[model samples]
Target: MFSSDIKIHIHGTSFTIHTPSGKINISLPFLGYQNISNVLAATALSFSLKIPLKKIKNGLLATPILSGRLELIELKPHKILINDTYNSNVSSMISAIQVLDKMPGYKILVSGDMSELGKKSVLYHKIIGNTVNLYKIDEILTIGQISYEISKISNNGKHFLDHRQLNKYLKKIFFNKNKITILIKGSRNTRMEKVVEYLIKESKKHVNFVV
Candidate 1:
């Protein structure tokens, strides 16, 4: 029920499709090319084959947003929190920092090291530190080994190598009366949710955790 020939022009590459699933003829433009042509070609072929559009629409609407990935929770004036701890890659980390930098309120970064970089592990950690400095983050609290590296670059931030250290420090400093805003972020493995939990409404000693 679809066209015999399907075409996808990505990066100025033309892929001509024949069968529902067959070898595709791909021609890419000059400079910076990868073999992702096969993926594009296959997608085109499958799309042309026989997939219901209603199923795609239903899937898009029903799919829930992944946790800790740009989850916004309102608390008080200028004290909103964004939970972006579901996953962490270099690009995602930089984007989170950029969001903090652009927004107002005393921003706090409770982040952990991004995992699975293979050989560029240390280099990536250092890049995180450098980006923090460039963004001029107000405060940074990190747990775990590599996360400590990120905190070290902050001129006015605290680094915690373990959860116990972080918990003790937060207990002392996270006052309920203060009017400062906070942002908590990290990799999913670090359990950044605990920090958010502690900042909930029950704790009256510190600034209002929720407005």
Candidate 2:
């Protein structure tokens, strides 16, 4: 459980935890409560190993996000992208959506598919849909057969047959956006990382070329 003194800010969160020695204040470079929960778990493990609390706090603050695993990218003057294409499941999908809900801007979830479920894949997808609705996500865009269930259940969702079609739609929607945050996710088998890469590449298109 998190300490009651937790302060979540736009860019980060700070919390004070009681330890045997006294109280230790911890801070992170990111704001997601799920991210903070992971840090708390890691801190517990470190405490069990008799590691110094100062070092634990410092280490947590310095750790960098693994690429394509809830990676946060700034899209120039107005938008942000959360690339969570490393893997997808009922829990992780919900966690990612929760993180997106904390962000500022128009929230969008881009999903591919969660694979390797012998059965109940559709049910799992529907759970994510319910979660999106619960959080009142602004929109959900989906690709793939199993993932389509998410959009179908969401109040404002659309399904794309292919990446090109989705990308085309995103470009149009992304134009002149005041503020937007997109969370892209799927299992490795779905190759959703391609969509992340395409978005990043497209974001750099407007950069002035000095030649």
* Top candidate (TM-score): 2
Candidate that scores best on lDDT: 2
RMSD of 1: 11.0
lDDT of 1 by residue, 78-177 (tens): 4566667677878878877876675566667778767887888777877888788888567888877787777777666677767767766655454542
Weakest 10 consecutive residues, lDDT, candidate 1? 27-36
Candidate 2: residue 9 Cα off by (Å):
8.6
TM-score per candidate: 0.60, 0.79
* Worst 10-residue lDDT window, candidate 2: 3-12
- Tell me the spans in candidate 2 whose CA falls farther than 4 Å from its real position: 1-34, 41-57, 208-211
Candidate 1: Cα lDDT at 131: 85
210, model 1: CA deviation in Å? 14
